[model samples]
Target: MSRLNHQWISQLPIKKITNVKPVSGGDINEAYQITTPDKKYFMKVQPNKTAKYFGHEINGLKALGKAIRAPKPLYNGQINGDAYLVLNWIDAGYQGSQSELGQLVAKMHSQTNDKFGFVDNHETGALNKTNNWDDNWSRFYVEQRLEPEIEACEKLGRWNKWRQQHMDNMISAFRKYYQNHEVVPSLCHGDLWSGNYMFDTEGHPLLIDPDAVYGDREYDLAMTTIFGGFNDEFYQAYQQTFPFDDGLQDRLQWYRFFYLCLHLILFGETYGGSVDSILGGF
Candidate 1:
């Protein structure tokens, strides 16, 4: 353990930790399971001067509240120039029923806001998510979500003439497709995907590492499909509670295109073909 971890652990309003074990499974930050004589805690650390999201993460988890079975924030602060966040460690459980996960997410999505965005900008795998308030969901998605990654990919030489032209055409027709159905400023997990959520020991769903925001609910649902693992029952349950209007199926790919662009920029060219294919459909 580093001195920073010791410093923060010592400061927590709990018994002194007797042991610390590195835990795998985090993609962006170092995760650890720290134990005392009778308790265990989960901690994530990010080096300072990189991206500090502990505060935003705490707010996001708290926003979800007990409505969703998410980790409870315990301690979060900077220690020795390292950003750290601590939470109650949840024990693994069997895969929760897809229907329950779906219903809980739908209930959480029912929480709405007047505008689309979050109070503070958050990091989605080193990428800054723009949360500037916007009353128009489509306009917000275009300017904040799509434009940033698209511009980054172009600057990184990931964009080609064909891709650029289709992207341009897609942007021109963005509002037309996005507005094909009714939408509200539904609270979203922002980065929802199979990996971000898990089942707790009680067979309940627990959402972790959220990039929460008030945006179109479709954006969240769209992410679940981009990466595999979500059962169809989850979608079915969500629709039963808050059904999408006609044309959502057509617009689903459009929403997914945003994430494809993000993956192209964040990971590599493996996602480039997918982005091109989605844009070509425009």
Candidate 2:
């Protein structure tokens, strides 16, 4: 924690700052457990240049509303060169049954919008994801989600001739699999891997660190499978609430490939083979 953070916490409209201790599980921001005489809060701080990231979070949580249990945004501001967001501190809780979590997530995904994207952009790990308004899901995903990461991989010397060919082929397959059809612009948690959510003390799920967007709700379900841990019950419950499209199971790898691209850019060759494996399916 920086001294500037301490100063900023002291100046908040609360009782005097009592204690500030470091917390873990955040990918991009420095997190801390802040205590005041009146209450406790979680503070997530990143560079001032990434202030928009925190702002997106505040807006995303507001959009989530009461549909899901998540950290309530209490404050968003800057301290020195860093931007910080304060949220209500939730007590650590044990993981709940997959079925319960799945049904709950389905209820949250029921929220929809007239179009795809968000009011603003969001980040996945360190990379920014554009949520520019587009009514067409395929065009929005291909242009905003896939292309930027592909370009990044090329610039980073990670895209070879064979890889480029495979990516192009995959995109072609994507177009064939998806057309401007009946896909709804459902609210998505955006990044819902195993590690991104937790349960509260009573074993109810509480989402954290959302990169929320409005897109094919299947995009969110697809991510649940990518990182593992979610059991068949979760999928079964989600399906019970909302059934899958005809080819969603077959097209799962393509959407998972997007996250693999993000990992390849963030962590390098360790994730390279995974991307290759997904492309091989096309």
Candidate 3:
């Protein structure tokens, strides 16, 4: 980790810092556990980036926090060419309630907007996500989400004619299916996975590191399945809180395809078979 500027650290309102130890934030940024006399804090730093680098994250945290337990964003600024974001830290715990997690997530998804998108665009690692508002979920998802990932994969030579043909078929099927269904613009944690959730010291589930958007709630639920953390209890609780419509199982595959295709673009062909598996069904 690069050395944090003492001059900048001293200027913060958080009083005298006793310690600043490096912690696992994510692949995209450098994380640290900041200690003061009375409280602890979490921070993420982006080297050579401006304070605006964390703008999307701050927006996401505030949006998610409205309906669920998320880290409270305390401060964000740039110092000596590095961007930093500080948030109130929640102490980790060993046990978590997946049932409660499900209910809370259901509530989070209940928060909705008239249009599909967010106030700002976001980035997952080096990739860009355009979140311009749209009235049509199908068009917003296809044009803003799927096509961008496909274009990136093509640029990296990870895409081919076979994949393109299958993708086209899948897109056609997706558009056709959504034509008859009514979709609400529900808030979603745009990059939810197993690692993004945790239990706090009091056994409260907290969501962290959100890449948020306002879109189909199913898109958020589909992400939970890609990684093996949430279980049957979670889904059951979610269904009890907010019932899913018919034909959801079939539609989930389309959202899964988008996530796997993104992994293929970010992590190469290791995810190709998984992507093809969904495409073959189309």
- The lDDT leader among the candidates is 3
lDDT of 1 by residue, 198-277 (tens): 89878888788888899888788888888787888988987898786777777688779988888889878999889878
The runs of at least 3 residues in candidate 3 whose Cα sits more than 4 Å from the true structure, single-residue gaps closed, are none
lDDT of 1 at 67: 66
Native-referenced Cα lDDT, model 1: 0.81
Q: Which regions of candidate 2 fall more than 4 Å away from where they truly are? A: 2-6, 48-51, 123-126
Instruction: Tell how far residue 231 is off in model 2, in angstroms.
Output: 1.2
Query: For model 2, how does the per-residue alpha-carbon lDDT over 38-85 read when each residue is reduced to its tens digit?
Result: 888988888764445588889888888668778899877766667788
Q: How does each model score on TM-score?
A: 0.92, 0.93, 0.97
Q: Residue-wise lDDT of candidate 3 within 143-249, one digit each (tens)?
A: 99999988898899988888899889989988997898879999898777988989998888988888899999999989999988999999999999999887788
Q: TM-score of predicted model 2?
A: 0.93
Using lDDT as the yardstick, the better of models 2 and 3 is 3
